[model samples]
Target: MSVRTIAVKYGVHRGTIPTFVLRSGGKLRSTGLNNERRASAAILYRDGHTLQEVADRLGIDPKTVRNAVVAEGISPRPRGRRPMAI
Candidate 1:
């Protein structure tokens, strides 16, 4: 489907469509899906849960969890290990 068709179907401006895929050969990820997942992660994270724990609960990768958190402008705490002090 063309970008214009997708925009009209989704009731969004044609110019608002995304331009990148998650990976070169992978199917293009849905902007709506990303938004929904990000919102879900934010709610869970705000309620006090680690990224790995959230990823497990959401059945997604820790990286995707982190991406969602970042996309929402939330700075999720570092997972696994702490950085060394200088």
Candidate 2:
């Protein structure tokens, strides 16, 4: 479980949970996109899906999706809306 979850369950501050974990030699997990999610984000972006679209489909933040696609060596599309072609 995440520290936040534990804190909420036991009524402790989220910050205090991390301190207790460190004192007990427990390691905290690093958050963010994993390899599979990154690959999925990249493929979706390459297939012309907007970052926000991919994020919504994957239930993650758009910035996280953006980072995932970039890490997969895909260049991000230009910002702002694209003009619909005639």
Which candidate number maximizes TM-score?
Answer: 2
- TM-scores vs. true structure, each candidate: 0.52, 0.64
Quantify all predictions' global Cα lDDT against the true fold.
0.72, 0.87
RMSD in order of candidates? 11.1, 4.3
Task: Give the per-residue Cα lDDT of candidate 2 at 72.
Answer: 92
Q: Candidate 2: where is the Cα deviation over 4 Å?
A: 1-20, 24-29, 81-86
How well does model 1 score by local distance difference test? 0.72
Pairs of residues clashing in candidate 1: none
Among the numbered candidates, top lDDT falls to 2
Candidate 2 structure quality by residue, lDDT tens digits, 1-86 = 97889999999999999899889999988777889888998898888788899899999999999899889998788986533555
